[model samples]
Target chain A: MTEEIIIAGFGGQGVLSLGKILAYSGIMQDQEVSWMPSYGPEMRGGTANVTVILSDDRINSPVLNEFDTAIILNQQSMDKFESMVKPGGLLIYDPNGISHHPERKDIKIATIEGAKEASELNNKKTFNMVIMGAFLKIHPIVLMENVHKGLEKSLPQRHHHMIPLNEKAIKVGMKKVKVIHDYKKLVAEE
Target chain B: MEEVKLMKGNEAMAEAAIRAGVDAYFGYPITPQSEVIEYLMHEEPFKRTGMVVLQAESELAAINMVYGAAACGKKAMTSSSSPGISLKLEGISYMAGAELPCLIANVMRGGPGLGTIQPGQSDYFQAVKGGGHGDYNLIVLAPSTVQEMADFVDLGFDLAFKYRNPVMILSDGAIGQMMEKVILPEQKERLSNEEIIKHYGNWATTGKPESRESNIITSLDLKPELQEIHNQHLQNKFKTAEKNEVRYEQIQCEDADYILVAYGTSARISQKVVQLGREKGLKIGLLRPITLWPFPKKIISELADHAKGFLSVEMSAGQMVEDVLLAVEGKVPVAHFGRMGGMIASPSEVLDAVEKEINKI
Candidate 1:
């Protein structure tokens, strides 16, 4: 199985790191993964994006045109990546800065109030982890145990003490996510 | 000890250099490749392995520093991007002329001059065709994955010392910046000054030893005939490399009607094209040149005899296609598809190009 995902947001929003964590989690599960970030000038306070591919087999290309999932964090990303999601795919977004909500019908849409939730937790750094948790809740690509392992692997040794707070934020995100549309249920209804 | 870590291609290359027992790394910071030096600085290989990592004033200085260290029989390396590499051409030429064993990495970006800081294979001709002014060839190894980025540090250094020639790791920004799981090489002790004097004492400038005559490292010759002879000697070394060091990987080429020739990042994209084309019952294969310089002429010529057509995919305005056409010798239809100036050609676009070439056959 292969899952092509694009995670996009502002530069300091932890977009690339979120994708990196997901890729690392895939590695924890003995899966093949790639993390391709948008580098150069675009990453300096501009919109940042990364294409992450996790596969049971070898991943051919790190860059992809379309994706099975898109975790959008801002309005610019939401506007740009809304149509790039494949039909019957999943689109997860933090509805904080999104001016125009996704209007697609063929795919599933889920929202997590990541900014508000992170602020509520008094740790803005955990915003991306919240969104990651929401995405994992929708599609359990990796086991929760592996996510903890991935965090330990990815975070610096000095930041190990913060993993517990990040874990709590992730669990909060799992409960806070609201599924706007379920493609499977829509198909069944039809 | 085998250790698996998720690392950027640039960082992996630096880590590998330390583990490979590299003596020194002199480099200037450049986009998409600065991480190599940054990693080296943070790791402080000087403390761990007694390896020297210096930040040079410019690419020119960095390459010249490499030349000086290499002349002393030290395993020295330098890395840069396209524009920075342009500044290093003169030093590289001097190293080639003097037959200095050193490693250089070009994490290429779009370029004619400061073109773009994004990933591009535009340096294909510049790298494989000798960017410097001389009748010489640098052993060019193209790495598609981060693992190879790490692995080629050792391999490139081995080949450089084997032939007493400079080697280049010709990578693109995509591979340099992307992250992947790499099995890092085991740490090896850096060669001490006594070891350098022992192994390379004959030709190296390791002070005048009473045991032998003083060794001089210079590219100058007062007589034109003597310079011609030196050129011939360098050419012979290149010929030896062509025969012994050519490296490539063929994917599903055994039973295929169409072949796609690509390297580095383009090869990664072409692998997807191969899979997608096979799903549609279109027998397409990928021929990836791991070593771009020894050109893999024999293998491509052999594939041309069986394949119906060839498509050269690249991130430049069709550079490597020239070599492919030369190998094929007009035996079959060969087409070129590329995206220049930092834009990457997607897998579907590569498949479309393949279909367009296949339809002609």
Candidate 2:
């Protein structure tokens, strides 16, 4: 099985790092993975994104136009990537700066109040971890044990003290995510 | 066994150079490839492996340093992007003429001049066809994965030393920036001056011993006849490389009706095209040229006999297509599909080009 994901947000929003963690988690499970980021001037205080692909078999291309899942953290990213999701795919977004909500009827849509939740948790840096928790709640591509190990590998040793807090933020995200539309249920009704 | 780690292509190459017993690294920083030198500086291979890593003031100075080190029969390397590589053309030509063995990497970006700092394969002509003046050829290796970016360092150095010719690792920004799992090689010690004398003492200018004739390394020949002979000798070396060093990968080619030919990142996209076409019951295959200089003409010529048509996909305006045409020799229709100025062609786009070629055939 292969899963292609695009995580996009503002430059400092941990968009690239989120994707890197997912890729590392995939590796923890002994899966083949690739992480490619949109680099250069565009990544300096501008919209930054990364494409991560995890597969049981050899991965052919790291660059893709369509994705199975799109984790959008900002309004600009949501607007740009909302339609790029494949039919019956999943799109998870943060409702913080979204002026226009996603209106697609062919894909599954989920929302996480990541900014509000991070503020409530009193740690704005855990915003990305919260979104990742919501994603894993909907689709458990990698096991939680693997995700914990991945965090250990990705973060510096000094940051290890915050692992429990990050874990708490993820659980908060998993509990707070709201499903706006379910494409599978819609198709079943049809 | 060495451990596996997820590494960027440029960083992997730097680590590989340190482990490959490279004597010195002289390079200037450029976008999309700065990580190579940055990793080297951070690792401080001089402290770890006794290898010298220096940041040159310019690409010209870096390549000249390579030339100087190589003249002493040492393993030296330098890397740059398109514009910086352009600045090193004169030194590269001199290295070829002087029969110096060194490694150069061009993490290509879009260009005629000062192109965008994004991934591109537009340097195909400049790399495979010799960018500098006069008669010369560089053994060009095209790597599509981060692992290859590391493996090719050792391979490049070995081939350079075998033929006493400069070799180039031709990669693009996409591969340079992407991260993937790589199994790094074990560290090897750098060759000492005494070892260099023992192995390459015949021609190396290692402080010419009193017992032998003085060794000289120069690209100049005052007599036109001697220069002609030198040029012919270089030509013969290129021919030997062409015969023995062509490398390529063929995927799903047997019983296929159409074939896609590409290298580097374009090859990655073409692989998806092949898979998508096969899903639609189209018999499509992909041929990736690992060595751009040798061109893999024999394989392409053989495949042309049975294949309905060929699509040459690249990031340039159809430079490699000329070579493909030469290989096919009008046996089947060959078309070109490309994106220029750092733009990437998607899988669907490549499939559309393949469908068009098949229809024409």
DockQ of 2: 0.84
Among residues 3 or more apart in sequence or in different chains, the pairs in candidate 2 whose N, CA or C atoms overlap within 3 Å are none
Residue A6 CA displacement from its true place in model 2, Å: 0.4
Model 2 chain A lowest lDDT segment of ten:
A13-22
Q: Model 1: per-residue lDDT, tens digit, B62-110? A: 9999999999989999999999999999999999999999999999999
Worst 10 residues of 2 chain B by lDDT: B196-205
* lDDT of candidates 1 onward, in order: 0.93, 0.93
Best by DockQ: 1
lDDT for A90 in candidate 1 is 96
**What TM-score would candidate 1 get against the native?**
0.98
**Model 1, residue B145: displacement in angstroms?**
0.2
User: What is candidate 2's CA lDDT for residue A150?
Assistant: 86
- Per residue, candidate 1 scores C-alpha lDDT tens digits across A1-190 of 9999999999999999898889899999999889999998899999999999989998898888789999999999988999989999999998887889999999999999999999999999999999999999988999989989999999999999999998898899899999999888988999
Chain A TM-score of model 2 comes to 0.97
